[model samples]
Target: MRRDILEHYKSTGTYTYAGPYSEYFKSLPDDIRQLGNLICSQVIHRVTLREGNSGANSDLRYGDMTRFPWYRLRCEDDVLMTAAAMTAELFRLDDRGFTFQRATENKIVVT
Candidate 1:
């Protein structure tokens, strides 16, 4: 899966400009990237759950793994945000039948 994701990123140049966070995500080892992809695959859609009313009746959830510090260490907020943006862009690009080039060596502009 990691190889496939990397191949798609390379082939389509679908990189996201994550500022300093680009290095953090790009430098991740293959195993870690695979793990991240696995987690992301599980969360392709938005999820919400009802909570007993205590002022809050509903809660938005990404994934339970997101609450772990170790997961956060491996996938920082910036990285996750950028990934989400990139995924959205990927869908848009696919709809338009277009592929983009990387704007920089480390990242692709999110916009």
Candidate 2:
């Protein structure tokens, strides 16, 4: 079922959120939805999937989907992103923030 959706996205390079899949995805559990969000983002934004393991077979992108766990993400290159995330955590580099406006006498929101 999901594979058909993926194939459709791959073929058309278009994304739709209001179809039957929207409620279907909303009903899914958190962990699975995490991956689903990633897939949707990649499809809509055309983000390239990282080749995690240098020696991993490229043909085995989604291996053994019938199993409980998918190891595709486990094989991605995590070091650079992990370092950036750690630095962001250390520096509190979040995009959402607020500051006081002296002239308007109000708080300004940043996001």
Candidate 3:
């Protein structure tokens, strides 16, 4: 399942820009489509350094266990804001790292 997600990321650059969500979305059950869509609508995406970069500069790069680059889910809008709060409540009960300020209106900007 993990490998399948990595393959999907390599084939499409969307997840790299949007974060490592395609797999998480795909793993969702049919009943959870709404939640998945909510995640899609709210999370900001980002890509990490390439595999080869580690050899060139350790500080500048790191390898992900998955072949695809590591993605950061930026939470900045109502959709993302809600989602982050929910995710934090459920999975990160003790951690508030998932919480973030509302992003700028532009989807591409993290603000």
Estimate TM-scores for all models.
0.26, 0.21, 0.20
TM-score-sorted candidate list, best first: 1, 2, 3
Q: Give the least accurate 10-residue stretch of model 3, judged by summed lDDT.
A: 102-111
What ranges in model 2 sit over 4 Å off? 1-14, 32-54, 58-61, 64-111
What is candidate 2's lDDT per residue for 20-82, written digit by digit as tens? 334544554468666554333211110222332222423433221222123323322243133
* Superposition error at 59 for model 1 (Å): 17
Q: What does candidate 3's lDDT look like per residue over 7-85, in tens digits?
A: 8755634223324344543555565666555434323334322232354433432222133323423433333333333
Of the two candidates 1 and 2, the one with more favorable TM-score, higher being better, is 1
Error of 1 at 61 (Å): 11
lDDT per residue (tens digit) for residues 8-66 in model 1: 76652334455444554455446966756543433323111112222232242232323
lDDT of each: 0.36, 0.29, 0.35
Total residue pair clashes for candidate 1: 1
Q: Which segments of candidate 1 are over 4 A away from where they belong?
A: 1-8, 11-15, 37-44, 48-111
